[model samples]
Target: MEIDFTNIKVIGFDADDTLWVNETYFREAEEEVGKLLSIYETPNKIDQELFKMEIKNLPTYGYGIKGFVLSMIELAIELSNGSVSNDIISKMLAIGKDMINKPIELLVGVEQVLSTLSKDYKLIVATKGDLLDQERKLENSGLLKYFHHIEVLSEKEEKNYSKLLQHLEIEPSEFLMIGNSLKSDVLPLVNMGSQAIHIPFHTTWQHEEVSHKDGHSSAFKTVKTITDVLNIIY
Candidate 1:
């Protein structure tokens, strides 16, 4: 489908996997945690339970590494029947720290796309995560200069996107969202009468996966990479 972006005045970009590496680290952490607790449960089982724990804690902890680490710790304690040692817990903490401290890796063509689009359309980051961590990443990414606004949303549902569009003083028709997750970046904007372009990452968290039964709109376009966006809007 040839989705037009002629009316799009403001574009929202999802950070993390959209522009940089994110889910890869989480996957790595999960594997490390699985090994750390391998005596109690198999790696597959550990991974599954950790996902469940993260989902269960989402409301209370929101998103980001802190909540994820907490979930890991909780899972460890439970798996060990409350006997998981301080040494093991410390190793888990180290894992989280390692993830946080890792250098940012921008996906190919991110800078080219952002730099090109910023010249014509208003660019903003509409990412969901802990504010401090996201802010720090933006700072580290050296791509912070491109965005007109940066929002660290707790959720990215239709209501949240509606609120963001309202706050920007622009009608939904004038806004477009580009991101890796269809569930977070594309669907919400499309549902709210906005346009969206999807750039799928190599890996996606299980939580962000959507089914065809969800019924998406014709208002969005899916592309192979971030650079494919230039081919669309031009």
Candidate 2:
């Protein structure tokens, strides 16, 4: 997939699975909570119960640690005979906070590629997650300087991409979206007439992965790693 970056003034990125590790930490935390909940219910039952809580809370709290904490507390209250203790909730909250505050290990060649691309393109982070969590990770990773615009969206839909392109005041064809998620980062931009590079990450959230059919080849290009991206666009 050969690309000419000279014409691309703005390069948009997905923060979580694209730039650094994210989803895996949340999965770990969820598993830890699941183990505690198993004392009250079966694993499968626990998943169903917790998922129900997630759907109910999404309206009020959105994504990231705050919603996750609320869901866990809700589950604890429901299962623990209405005697949910603050100590258990506090411990889980600390773990969730640590997941964000902890050092991020960039995927192989992520920094090197971004450093190279930033020199020639207008880099922007178009990621959707907890606002404060994403911001803190960016600040802690020390990669904040690479991006001129940091957008923390609640949803990553076609409209979000449209607004981003509009805000940047560039045509869709002139922008390129780069990230690991097909649903959030790639397809939305591709559907909007912008180019997209799909660099597959080993771990992705359940919601982010998109199924690719054989016919839709022109708009989407998948790579095994970030280093592979340099061969195409750089």
Candidate 3:
């Protein structure tokens, strides 16, 4: 479907996989967690249980490496029948710290796209994650100057985006969201009468994946890379 962004005044970008490397580290951490708990269960089972634990803990911990690490620790104890060693717990903590400190690697053409688009649009970041970690990544990304606003949302449901657009004094018809997650970034905005472009990363969190059938009626566009955004908006 051809989307006319001619009326889009404010373009929101999702930070994690859309602009920089993020979900990749979480996959790596999950692998390490799986290996660390191999004695308690098969790697596949461990992974499954860990995902369940994450979902269960989402309400309490929200999202980010700290919450992930806590979930891992809890899973370890439960899988090990409360006999998991402190050493394993310490290793999990280290994994989370390492993830937090990973270098901010921007996706290809991110800066150029931002640089070009910022000239004609009000660019902002509308992402979900721990506020401090998201802020830190933004500071480290060196792309903060290009954005007119930065919002680290606790969630990315329709109401959240509605509130954000309202707070920014933007009309839904005048807004566009670009991101890698259909669940968090695309569908919600499309459902709210805003335009969204999905730029798929090589890897996506299972939680963020959605069936095309689920959003078949929502008007949105999908691109292969961040630079491709220029084609639609320019």
What's the lDDT for residue 56 in model 1? 99
User: What would the TM-score be for candidate 3 when compared with the true structure?
Assistant: 0.97
Residue-level lDDT of model 2, residues 44-115, one tens digit each, is 787677778887888789878778777888898899888767777787778777776768878778788889
- Tens digits of per-residue lDDT for model 3 on 1-234? 446799999999999999999999999999999899999999899989998999899999999989999999999999999999999999999999999999999999999999999999999999988999999999999999999999999899999999999999989989999999989999888878899998888898878878869645437888898999898787
User: Candidates ranked by lDDT, best first?
Assistant: 1, 3, 2
For all predictions, the C-alpha RMSD in Å is: 1.4, 2.4, 1.2
Report the C-alpha lDDT of model 1 over 39-144, residue by residue, as the tens digit.
9999999999999999999999999999999999999999999999999999999999999999999999999999999999999999999999999999999999
- Model 2 residue pairs with clashes: none
Q: Give the TM-score of candidate 2.
A: 0.90
CA lDDT, candidate 1, residue 102: 90
Candidate 3: where are CA atoms >4 Å away? 215-218
Candidate 1: list runs displaced more than 4 Å: 213-217
Clashes of each: 0, 0, 0
lDDT of 2: 0.80
